[model samples]
Target chain A: MEFSTIIQILDSAVRLSTPLLLACLAGLYSERSGIFDIGLEGKMLAGAFAAGAMSAYAGMPVTEGGLGMTWGMAWMGVLAAVAVSIVLAMIHGFASITLRGNQLISGVAINFFAAGSTVLIGQHWFRSGGQTPPLSGAQRFGPINLPFADAVKDVPFLGPIYEGLISGHNILVYIAIATVPLTSWLLFRTRFGLRLRAVGENPGAVDTAGISVVRQRYAAVLIAGILCGLAGAYLSLGTSAAGFVKDMSAGKGFIALAALIFAKWRPRAALGACLLFGLLEAIGNRYQSIDLGAFVVPVQFMQALPYILTVVILAGFIGKAIPPAAGGEPYVKER
Target chain B: MNKGLPKWADVVLIPLLSLLLAFLVSGLVVMFIGKDPIQAVQVMVSGALGKFGIGYTLYYTTNFIFTGLAVAIAFHARMFNIGGEGQAGIGGVGVAAVLLSVAWPHWTIAIVAASLGAMAFGAAWAAIPAYLQAKRGSHIVITTIMFNWIGSALIVYLLVGPMQAPGMVPETVGFSAGAAIPTLHDIFPAFDKHAPANVSLFLALIAAFAVWVLVWKTRLGYEIRAFGHSEKAAVYAGISPLKIIMVVMLISGGLAGMMAVNTVQGEAERLILDTVQGAGFVGIAVALMGRSHPVGVVLAAFLFGILYQGGGELSFEMGIPREMIVVIQALVIMFVGSLENMVRIPVERLFVRFDKGAA
Candidate 1:
């Protein structure tokens, strides 16, 4: 394979990995706080719709019959998406925390509710066939040309790769990358992280410390909401795809869950898993059929690879995946 | 916060209140969307229960009953089997293979053979996740979900590549007439003349009863409940977790597999793409609403059957998005299954007060 082709693939992989990375990390926080979030997909879908609708309503070109807000105001869309996601996170927290509900059932209900409500609201508000209007200019994220990108262009090997693959992603991609370490530190080195992990592992210990398990879990869920909200914003505003399509998240959210498990719920490991899945996706996108002269691997196989890998990983082909001890169980103070 | 409730209130009153709350919120959402909530309900009732609509409703109800029973059986063992969608898809392949393999002399033999094949295929498919959960400690929920996607991809590959009809169409060839189950219209001429509701409905009812008996009356059922309630105690009592998980999944998968019969043999008479159409997921809601009981599953299935048929009509006639029904169903599941304690707590308190007064 040529270097440029590899660069292109890596570049797309970075782009595609952003949403999955963000969503996976979001799940890590929620699950580590003892709330098994099977509704990441639902939350991401809700985020995507909120971002697209808000951006379109605010910053689609007035020439194209938009709401006439400036490009800078388009970021209000991200804010709106975050708000919507937080509300969902609160509902999840309420159902699973305050009520001590079945977390999986709550998650499943959220998925259904999110999928239905978003489409219904989208059609009701926009009337654009369950899609937001086209976004333009600053409403959509454009590539950020890093300082010295041109200066590094002439350097050998690493130069072209850096310029082509690393230096030119929307800001959200950068945020997603930076999040891995931040999440790692927060999960490992911070006081809140210590309490969070303790709560997930043994909430009784945390509760005895006078820290409310419900409050800690709620905080973790809210963090998840913020990260997932950013993911949704990136999907609509960061990528070249500037509009929300109905059910556009497809299975990405579920794939994120797979990544969370594949990474064994570690933030650093999650980064690798997300990027690996992203690379596989990128390969499928580019190479409909990979040819090595003698034989070709079918696109169907390529498309199915991630799910297959998820199954194999979850089946302990590699290692035992131990979830946080108290995951999916609503923490009961007395019990 | 009270834990105890009268048995009658535990089963009936909680679900009723939850259903009422779900509908109340759904009504608010409908009104918010500029549609009259009352009119929407009226339309839904008329569309789902009208003679013409009842047939379609029952057809959908038949599908849910199989899948709901599938879920309920797994629930009995505390195994969350979320892969009913994929199992049903695989079951469709089994049904198609059997239907295509022979020119049977009679529908009776053909239907029985197909039913057996579907159960086997679904059970086999489910066994993968079950094995992982039992032997590897992999969470059943995540593994089953992955399998759902894999199953869909496999079906797409087969339908597009190998199983495609000789012509350009993307489905398998139609089943032989001998393999086709008789529609309700054929069995009961006195009933609606063109109902797609079929004999599979009867089979679904029988399967529900079978599951109930298996769960409540049999020694196996006792072991399953014991294991689900306390694996440590059950183990001490000599019950094998592996055996229970594997057996429960197989039975659940078999019941889920039976869902394909309604669509493949009873209605479409071919293994078409998306034949299951999220009924597998809907089964989760149905089983929850039914409280994982056979009698409750039947009633819950009928309720969802009505929503589905009526939702379609609602979207068509009143311009209300059919997806609204999904919100309602999810709300019902949330309130009834997850937040059952919300109602149960208050009801228990009330019952305790009544008991104290009587004393």
Candidate 2:
């Protein structure tokens, strides 16, 4: 492959991987804390719809339910997405913790609720055929080229890779990148992280130590919601896309969950896995029909690669994935 | 968990209360959206239970029963098989391949052959995940979900490439009329003449009976129950976990795959992508609410059938978003499946007090 061509592919990889990375990290937190969130897709969808609808509304005239397009309005959209996701997270926490509900069932319910409510409200408010109107100007996230990117375009290998592959993205991409290290430190090096890991592996032990297992698990789930909220926002608003489409989160949340397991719930590994999955997606999009000596490969096969890969990996073709020992079981206090 | 409660209360009262809670909350949601809740409920009820609506409700119920039974069987083995969607999709391909390959003179023979094809294909789709979980310890839930997406994509590719009728649309040609299953209208002249409700509804009932017998009366069922209750104890008792997992998932996948017989041969009479839709996921809720029993599965499936048809009517009549129906369904599942304890504990306490007073 040509150097510039490779750089372009990497650029798309970075852009596409942003959502997966965010969601993957989100799943990591929830799963590591012993609450598997199958509803990541739902939460992300809710976030996308909220951010997209709110920002679009904010950009419109006040008479039309908008706050007049401003940077703050977009930020408000982000905040709304996070808030909505947190509410959903709380619902999951309440059911699986306080009520001792089935975690998987609660997660599935959250997904269904989010998917349904977002479209219902979106249709009622926008009347735009199950989508939010496209945002413009300050309401949508625009790309940002690095300070000296343009000047280095004429330089050789290093310059082309840096400029083409790493220079420009919407601001959310930078935030997602920064989160990798921040999440790593928070998960592996902090007091909270130690307690959270302990809670997942042995909530009974954590309980005996006087830390509330319920609170720790809830905190982890809420943190997941925050990251997933950003993921949903970046998908509809921060990316080159300008509007929210119903069911647009597609299966990315599930794929993110797969990536989390693939990384064995490690934050740093999740980043790598997301980027690799993103690269595969970019390749699939770029080369729909590949001819190697014989008949061409079909487009659907490429599109299905990530899911197929996840299943294959989980089927133990790679390495065995071991979940937290105490995962999926409700903690009960003894009398 | 069963302390101070009768079997009937555990079976009936809890589900009823959960259902009531779901409707009340759904009503509030409708009011919040500025729609008249009473009118919405009235429209939904009339639409679902009245003349033409009853036909579609039964039609959807037929599909739900198969998938619900599929989930129920897996639940008995303590396995989470969420790939019913994918299994049914593959099963559609099986039904189509069989119907198109043969020009059976009668619908009776064709239906039987299509069912066998569906079961085989569905079981094939589920086997890999079952084996992985049984042997390699991979989580069946994640693997099955991933397979759903893969199955959909595979079907899309097949329909667009090799299976496409000479048209540009990504669907196969319709099945020959001779192979079309007889509808309810044919069997009962008094029934709605054009309702898609077919003999498959009868088959669903039969399948439920079969499941009840298998889970209750059969030795294999005893093994499955024992394994589900405690794998370590089951192993000690000579009930191999591997055997139970594989056998149960095969049965589950086959049941789920059988849904395609209704959609492919009985209704649309063609192989189309997305024929399964979200029925597979709905099966999970149905199984949960039904407490993983056949009779409960049928009852729960019928209720969802009503919700789907009625919800459709509400959206059409009141301009409520169609998505609200799904929200309502989700709420029902949440209350009945996840938050059952909220109502159960209170009910158990009440029942205990009444018993004491009577004594």
Candidate 3:
């Protein structure tokens, strides 16, 4: 492949991985806090719908049945995404934490609920076959060019790499990348983070320390909701599509969950894992099939690679991927 | 051994109450969409239970029964086999391969061979995940989910490359006429001739009864339930976790595979992409609502059948998306599976108070 081709693939990879990175961080918070969340897909879907609807409404004129606002309304869309995702997360928390129900089942229910309701409500509102109206300037997160991107573009190999790979992403992409270091700092340096990790590993110990296990878990779930909301918003707003398509998350959430496992629940590793998955996807998208002199590889195989790799990793072929000790179990006070 | 609630209440009442709650929420959603909730229910009832609709309902019920039992059997061993969709899809391939291999003289013989082929293929698909879960401690849920994606990809490859018919369509040629299972209308002339409900419905019922017998009346069943209740206790009692896991998964996968007979051989009579549809996930809701019991699974399967058939009608008549049924199914699973304690605690308290008064 040519250098520019590689750069282009990497560019798309960066764009695609932003959502995975965000959702992976979301899963990192929830799973590290001992709550196994298979519902990340559902939360992201709900968030995407909320963001898409809000942004579209914000972009339209007042006479055309819209909020008639510009630039700042996209932020409101992100907020709406977060709020809706948080509500769904609270439902999962209520079922798993308070009701002490099966975490996996709750996740499954959430997925079905989101998959069904997003389109149901979207169609009811838009009558566009479950899709929000296409967004435009000021309504979507337009790409941002870093300082000297234009000046540096004509310089050399390193210049094209810098401008093409690093600079022009929507605000959410930057936020997603920035979140990794912030997450690492919060998880490792803060007292709250210590208690949060403790609850996932050993809730009884945290409980003995007079830290409320429930409160820690709820907090973790809330953070997961916020991160997932951003990921969803990024999908509908930050991407070139600039509209919510039905089922548009398209298994990205599961891929994010897989990235979380591949990363072993670390923020830095998650970024790397998400990028790797993203590159795989970008390569698949760029070239429908790769040709070698001897034979050809099909696109389906490429599409299935991430899931296949996750299974291989899960099977302990590479290494044992152990979950947090209390993950998937409800904390019972007296049991 | 008696809990706060009576046995009958535990078996039937809780699910009924959950169903009621699910419908109540569904009604609210309908109202939110500026549609009449009562009228929607009326359309659903007539669309699912009316003479023309009942045949389709039964056909859907047949698919759900196989998938529901598949999940329920795995549930007994505390394994969540979420790959029913993949298993059933692969099972369709098996049925297609078997039915296409020979032009049998009799439908009965062909059905038997196709059923075996379907079960074998489904079990084979599930074998890897079961082994990984049993030996390496890989999470079954994650592995099975990955398998669903892998299985779909495999189907696409097969349909496009090797198994493609001599046409533009991404499907196999129709199965031999003898291999085709007779629809319900063939035996009962009163039913709609085009409806897909077929003899596979009987097979599903038989499978359900067999599952009940295997789970409750057999030593293997005892070991599975014992393992599910407490893995350490079962291990101490000499029950092999590996054996229970593998056997239970094989049975589950085989049962899931049987759904192909209804959809592939009986209805479509050709191998097509997405043959299983979302019936596999519906199995999860059914198994949960049924409390992982065979009888309950059948009843829950019928309820989902109504939702599916009715939802299809709602899409045509009421402009409600077919996905509305999925929403209702999700709510039912939420209430019955995850939020049981929400109802159980209050009911238990009431029952305890009543017992105290009687004493």
**Candidate number with greatest lDDT:** 3
Count of clashing pairs, candidate 1? 0
lDDT of 3: 0.91
**Tens digit of lDDT per residue, candidate 3, span A4-109?**
9999999999998999999999999999999989899999999999999999998789999998996787888899999999999999999998898899999989
- Residue A325 in model 2: shift from native, Å? 1.3
TM-score of 3: 0.98
Model 3 agreement with the true structure over B195-261: per-residue lDDT tens digits: 8899999999999999999999999999999999999999999999999999999999999999999
Off by over 4 Å in 1: A60-66, A291-296
Worst 10 residues of 2 chain A by lDDT: A64-73
Per-residue lDDT of B1-359 in model 1, one digit per residue for the tens? Answer: 33557677878888999989889989998988899999998999999998788888999999999889898889988999989999999999988988898887798898899899889988988999999899988778888888888899888888888788888777999988888788887877755767679889999999989888889999999999999899999999999999999999999888888888888888889888899988898899899989899999999999999999999989989998878888898888888877777787778888888888999
| Candidate 2 residue-wise lDDT, A230-258, digit = tens | 99998778866687898888889988888
Q: For residue B81, give model 2's deviation from the true position in Å.
A: 1.7
* Model 2: number of backbone collisions: 2
lDDT scores of the candidates, listed in order: 0.87, 0.88, 0.91
Q: Sort by lDDT, best first: what order?
A: 3, 2, 1
True-vs-predicted CA distance for residue A89, candidate 3, Å = 0.3
CAPRI-style quality class for the chain A–B interface of candidate 3: high
**Model 3 segments more than 4 A misplaced:** none
Which pairs, if any, clash in model 2?
A57-A66, A58-A67
On a 0 to 1 DockQ scale, where is model 1?
0.73
